[model samples]
Target: MQRLVLRRKEFSLFQAFIYKNIGISLGDHKIYLVQARLAKRVKQLGLESFGEYYDFLVADRKGGELEYLSSLISTNVTSFFREHKQWEFLKSHLASILERSGGRLRIWSAACSSGEEPYSIAMFLAEHLPNMTQYDIKILATDVSPKVLKIAMSGMYSQKACMSLSDEYLRKYFSPVLVENEAYYQISDMLKKQIIFREFNLVTGDYDLFAQKAFDIIFCRNVMIYFDRPTQNKLVDRFHAILAKEGHLFIGSSEALTDMKKEFKSKSASIYQKA
Candidate 1:
């Protein structure tokens, strides 16, 4: 098979399309990177050129191809308890958060790549809170890609994925399973029931669906670095709008709201409270 090259023109079209739909800013130098990432899919589909794939995506009225494209371009490098500092902050303020909520809490794990974030949230709460079933807590885990959501719904993980978790968490939250004689850890149904997974495109999804709802905590970490400034500001504003009073927003420590004016007051590194 002849190597398919993503021409400059095709790269420009994809760059604009991705930014418009997903709010990701791919630089001009990323032409090769995009090509390398997407070339296999293009080849598997028997497409002759990247331009043809673009046309296919445009003609895909159901938006499935675009979701697949989003998956390829976006990295899904996540693990159990990836951000240690954020959890520490949450632990410090957990009592106040519970007091404010009065035993009811809603958390949104935005861009929940492969379900580890929400699952970790469930496990953490079960570990920290006094009663196992007293509080009302639910996690809404959403992502733009359906492919990842399917994996999340399965609640299965490789042994490598379980490395970050503690032995106690492993014993309480997960069950060891043998899949074709290979070891795998599957999250217990008790924890799985605590989460609701859905397909949500943060850049293009409608916020009106949340007009009547507000979350106590939102975890939109490590995702904004892919977006440009204007896009980031717009997305941040949406998050601010849907957060309950004094609700918390957790972002990646590396990603900061430097020049943006907003209602959130910084409490700690990458942790914000709605004012």
Candidate 2:
């Protein structure tokens, strides 16, 4: 990849541009990183400079170019059963949570990438909450990137994604399909029915968390690392507002709210309860 050395002013301009357009705040030090990630697109478009590419992103009216730009900027690294401790907590507390909320359950897998986390939740609920059949159990999965959301809605994955799941759960919850020497597991329709996928941008608008209803559990793990301190604070406050009384918020294992206002108190190492 060709290294495009961006000047400090140019970097700031690009950052402002993207923040205005897509709500991603790239710092000055990320110039090289941005170039590295986007160099291929620049070359493929036969652009002479990063500025030209930026202009195209802003001015492109076809919508495809803008979608491609958003796809490049968004981060989508995720795995099945990440942070197993949280899942353990969910399993332990499922009965109590359901009981406390009058047997109605709504979970928001915010920033769900390629459907792993939500599907894991569905599988867990399927295994543990047999009473879920009588109750309203729904998982709302949302992401900013439509591409990733489409993949997530498909609920198809390779064996690597299901490695953490047990054989019994795998056989019961998913069906295998052979495609070109590799097997892809498709989530059973029963489990898929419990999840609702949508496109959402956490930074730009007001989500429907504070409407008539609220989520019982909000699993927004590993998503806030992209925002600055102010953005993080705003997002956390929004989370606190939308979360039902006594609702739980699960964040990334390494992420904490030390820098932000303490609306949620730590219940466990990485879990916080809305206060």
Candidate 3:
């Protein structure tokens, strides 16, 4: 089998396709990256060139190939309790937030990769919220990749994935099991019961679905960094529209709102409150 080189023309086509469909902006330098990431998959599909792969992605009406492309182009490196500062901020403000909502707390873990972020929210609330049974708390965890969502729904993690977790949290929230001589931890039903996972494409998804739903906290961390400025601004606007008054928006530490910061007051580093 011959190695397929992704031509400049083919790269440009993909660049436009990804931006229009997925809201990610691929720079000129990323051509090599696209080739490196997708060439093997193209070969495995028995496609002769990157162009054919792109066509296959478009022609497949079910959008499964597009999902595969999304999984490849985006990085899903996540773990339990990522971005510690945001959690600390939530802890300090939890009481007031719950009070404002009258004990009905809704959190949206947008781009919840591999279930960790939403699960972390559940665990954090379970640990912090006093009289947790009295509160109607639910978390909606969404991501574009069904692959990761499947992992998330299972609520199982390998021993290596649970390294960052503390001893007490592990004992309280997870049950240990051996699968094929490998150690894994399953999330407790208490935590799983609080979350609902679904597939959503942030860029192309219908915002109308959330017209009636206003989230208290929207954790869209680390996702905006991949989008262009215009796409980022539009997404911020959509988030602003659906968030409750004075709701919080948590972004990745590496990302900033820039022009969109006017609509949201900065509470902490990469954390904003809807003004």
Point to the candidate with the largest lDDT: 3
The per-candidate count of clashes, in order, stands at 0, 0, 0
> How do the predictions measure up, each by TM-score?
0.97, 0.91, 0.97
lDDT of 2 at 148: 90
- Model 2 misplacement above 4 A: 1-9, 61-66, 208-210, 259-261
Error of 3 at 104 (Å): 0.9
Indicate the TM-score of model 3.
0.97
Better of 1 and 2 by TM-score: 1
Error of 1 at 92 (Å): 1.6
Tens-place lDDT per residue, model 1, 29-141, is 99999999999998889999899999998899998899899899988889998889999888899989989988789999999999999999998898888595988888999
The residue-level lDDT of candidate 3 at 69 comes to 89
lDDT comparison, 1 vs 3, better candidate: 3
Weakest 10 consecutive residues of candidate 1 by summed lDDT: 253-262
Candidate no. 1 TM-score: 0.97
Candidate 1 stretches with Cα past 4 Å from truth are none
Worst 10 residues of 3 by lDDT: 255-264
Q: Residue by residue across 178-253, what tens digits does model 2's lDDT show?
A: 8798998999999899999987778875567448668889988877788777778888988888888889999999
Compare candidates 2 and 3 on TM-score and give the better one: 3
